[model samples]
Target chain A: MTSDITLILRFLSILGGGAMAGILGSLTGLGGATVLVPLLTLFYGIPIYFATGASLISTIATSAGSASGYTKHKIANIKIGVGLEIATTAGAIVGSLTIVAVHEAHASWIIYVLFGIVLLGSLIPTIQRSSSEEPLKRKPDWTTRIFQLAGEYYDTKLKKKISYEGVRWWLAEIIMFFAGVISGLLGIGSGALKVLGMDWAMNLPMKVTTTTSNFMIGITAATGSSIYWYEGYIQLFIAGATAIGVVIGAYIGSRLLLKITNKNIRWIFFSILSFLGVEMLLEGLDKAKVLVIATTIEEMISIAVAIIMISGLYLKTRRGERAVKAA
Target chain B: MNVPSKQRDIDSITSLILRVGVLSSLSLIIVGVILLFIRGSADGVSISQIASFHSTFNSSYLNPTHIVQGLIAVDPLYFITLGLWVLIFTPITVVFTSMVTFITAGNRLYIAMSLIVLFNLFFAMLAIPSLIHT
Candidate 1:
């Protein structure tokens, strides 16, 4: 009887954790795996392999739940998403296969460090571009024309239609390929990289970038999941709970996203990126024995950095708003 | 300028499929979990045993024959397994439908693009793993 209670409690905890990850993932287009893996492993004491398996399931749930809404609203650009997916899917296959070689080399720490550096580096652009809702218009290039990378969406917050075109399609594709490789190597949805591909390289609006990234994550995750399945990584109870919770959270998050401003969404994304970046960096350092910090201290440092960065950005944005008001 | 009607149709269809797939799988999972709670075990595996962090029993142990047997006997764990299979295939279904949609639209570029992605998915999910095992 006590065992039954314990089981129920564990199930609920997993469900709650999955829901939280789903909300953040759907909101930021990071596919919730970023949050889910850490939460399950650190908080619940689930094994990392099982946590990753559950995280993959949550990613699909978030993508499916939120992408449906985004599609119905015409916020997710299907043409661009499908076109770029060719590179990501191919990259995923390569990355999954490459993991064997990487594990054999015992060089997985490098990937963690590289991933951390990439996340931290991308923050500069995210903060710089936070003030603008849309990118400056540029002349359409051939790649954009050939790929048909332009679309307009009705922005609820703006109460108007926003038409935008993605340029530098080749650059975006290259980035997406790396994104897929990273996803396959790491067993997480590389949503941040996908967002960067579209938002930075392709010059799509944040709203479009996020929703489209969410749309693509499902396909990417689906590719990797089969491998995880065959490897015996998926724990049925954990995955079942996480998938259900993530779907509910993702549904709520997609609704919230439509109502929230792009700047607000960027703030949320920025905070998550900072936290994840520092966590990954510390994890890599600890594993490499380069800087042997205790896990508690490492977490404290990541939280502190995330808090400082988020507050700094908030104050900067407020000051800018005040200046505009005075003007 | 507005989105083309054909494009809109594609979006609606895709969204519908995603919604259906996710919800149906979710329902199946929920039912299975509930059943497990009432039954206290699934397929001779106790709840505690299957729910453990270090549990060795997983998707690897599941096979088509066992899944079919579980479905026939209304095994709770197998229901969950079936639900997972559904969830995993949801996006693959979307990709397939999108390819078909592109074909009907006669959008040559997207048709080729979708076919490439679909093939990649198949290769990664089925071909590569089977080849490696062999």
Candidate 2:
């Protein structure tokens, strides 16, 4: 009975967290983390480290969920995302290796600094007025110019042609380089940087900027995630729960977008996240002492179960490989 | 002379739809790039956004052996081999992956419900000069 209640509570927290993440994530263009991580840690009393691990799972979930919607709409720009991924993925590996090295030293200060930064960011609105008004000057780049990197988007509202030329590809590359480094080093995604890089240097439209930033995050996170797993930072049970929740949340949220006005959605969404962001900042500050939980038997079982699944996959792969050889 | 519609036609239509879908996604990426540039300096874009989330959660990820590292005596250097795959396929895979997602979740009912809310929001937001400017 006690276990049942814990499970129920767990389910509810994740569901609620996911719901909040979906609404606010779409609104703020900051993805779901703007609300999820804080909701888990501050409201539900999930630890920050654990919350972050869980956040990564949800982040991937939201990405996966949105990937389908964006694909249906034909707006994800997989080519550009893929091209930039080469740089980001490589950087993630190095970033993960760095985190593993730093784990031994035990840095809480870094989290504090990161929290301060997010607190500062959460308050600010996603400024877009100038984005529409300014006559964009495409910063010349050999790669962008040669490749005709500029692209166009239809304003659903304006119902007219809105086009932009590529800005400073070199600058974007450099920003991604650092973003990748941070992705691995902190076990945090590089969406913030990728969005910023493309925006400031490339001059993409706002929706396009937000979506592509979302597009580019998968590889970087996946790269860093692989490294983090080897070094033993992720707790599978927590991550699994979080991942499932976020995927569902993002799906529902995007679907809800169909009903909600984008402007109202953005306003309500940012307002909620901003509220949650402040709450998170306060909780993080109040709790100075850190508590590290031991990995549970449930997680061990989860890993064991996964191993069984992998062995099955391996046998299949071997049989396929052998058949090819025979052919 | 006009040809009759057939299963092949539906398949071809779907394929074209998929192509257009991917093209649209690519277009959004382009637009998104411009939005980011006009908003602020590139450094501010990603770093601050990332810091915003990281600061809130500050986590250490777990290292999984078999799943990530692939330790169970497969081919030699399996992880290295997988890393090679990541090197090649991450970007394009997301596109292909999106198509799969649409097929799995492509219900007109769900999509339509979601859009009613989405488009109205975007129309009002985009048309209003005040929100666009600030």
Candidate 3:
């Protein structure tokens, strides 16, 4: 009876945790896998490999959940997304193969450390450009002309149709390959990298970049997950539960996103990223025998720090608002 | 069809495909999970074991035929897995749709591009994985 109770609790918690991660993902535009993997491996004591597989499988759920909404809005550039997918899928195949080789060599530590670095690296650019809603236009290049990389979408906030064209298609494609490899390697959709490829390299509008990147993530993740599925990495119950939970969370979050302010939430997100990033790095080092400590204590300290940082930011923002009112 | 109207048609069709695929698969998964809860075991595997990190259940051995077979047995695990398979194939269907849409629209470049993308998806999902396993 006690064992059955524990089983029920474990099942529920995994689903709940996945739902929370999904909410964060919807609000922040980062793939839920980035948060979900860390939550499972670091908090729940699941092995990183299993956690990654679960996360990867759940990514497909969120991608499917959101892609239709974006498609209906006609904000996602199907042409660009489909075009870039050619490279992403190819890269994903190579990346999954590389991970298989890495697993065979027992180099799991490398993946942990690399995932940490990638998570940390993505935070800076997100912090820098979180408020910017558009990208500066650039002149069309040869690849743009050949690919016909142009799109138009209605900007609800601006109440006008915005026309945009993407340039430097080769650059976007090259970056997309790297993004795909990251997706497969880390079992994430790597939306940050995809956005950077289109928004920065191709000079597309931010809306198009985000929606198109979201559109592309489903296929990119599917490519990687097939290999992971074959390798026995995906935990069926956990993955299934997480997938269902995340879809619910994403649905709720999409509604909440409009009601909440985005600015201060970004700072909170950055804090969590930094905390998880450092924790994963330490975990990798611990596994590599470069560092040794009680894993539970380390995880507790990281969570505490993240909580303190978030509260600190909240206080600062409130104080600033009071000051403005006084003036 | 003119350029703008053609674009609208593609967008509408694509949106409908996405909605139908995602919604149907999600509902199937939810029902499967609820059924699993009532049954408490699937295909000789207990819920406690299946929920564990070290679950030994190898789904790779379960192909489409096996899934169909299990469905007749009313195995919730196979139903859940089938739902997942549908989710994976949803994007593939979208890409295939785009291929046909472009072909009919007389967009030569997009037709070629979509075909390549479709080929890549097929290669990654079926061809390469099977090759590696074999």
Cα lDDT tens digits for candidate 2, A1-327 = 564445445545666666667545644445565566656665666545555555554554455455556544444444355445656655665665555455556754354345535533533324232324233676656767654466655555555556666667667778777777766664455466776777666776655666667656654565555344334344333444455455556666666653454445534544454444444444434343442223253234334544554455446546765887799
Q: DockQ for each candidate?
A: 0.81, 0.03, 0.59
Ranking by lDDT: 1, 3, 2
lDDT of 3 by residue, A26-135 (tens): 66656678788888988898877788888887787777677777777788888889989988988888888888788889989988899888887776556445344566
**Who is ahead in DockQ, 1 or 2?**
1
Rank candidates by TM-score, best first: 1, 3, 2
TM-score of each: 0.92, 0.59, 0.90
Residue B128 lDDT (model 2): 29
Q: Cα RMSD to native, each candidate?
A: 2.5, 21.7, 3.8
Displacement of the residue A312 alpha carbon in candidate 3, Å? 13
* Candidate 2 residue runs with Cα over 4 Å from true position: A122-125, A128-141, A185-187, A256-266, A269-327, B1-92, B95-134
Model 3 local distance difference test score: 0.78
* lDDT of each residue in A252-295, candidate 1, tens digit only: 88889888766777787788778877887888787789989988
Candidate 3 backbone collisions, by pair: none
Tens digit of per-residue lDDT, candidate 3, span B1-134: 12377777878888787667777777777777777777888888887777778767755655655888888899888888788778788777888877877888788988888787777777877787778878
Please give, for residues B89-130, the per-residue lDDT of candidate 1 as tens digits.
888888887788778878899999988999999898888867
Native-referenced Cα lDDT, model 1: 0.84
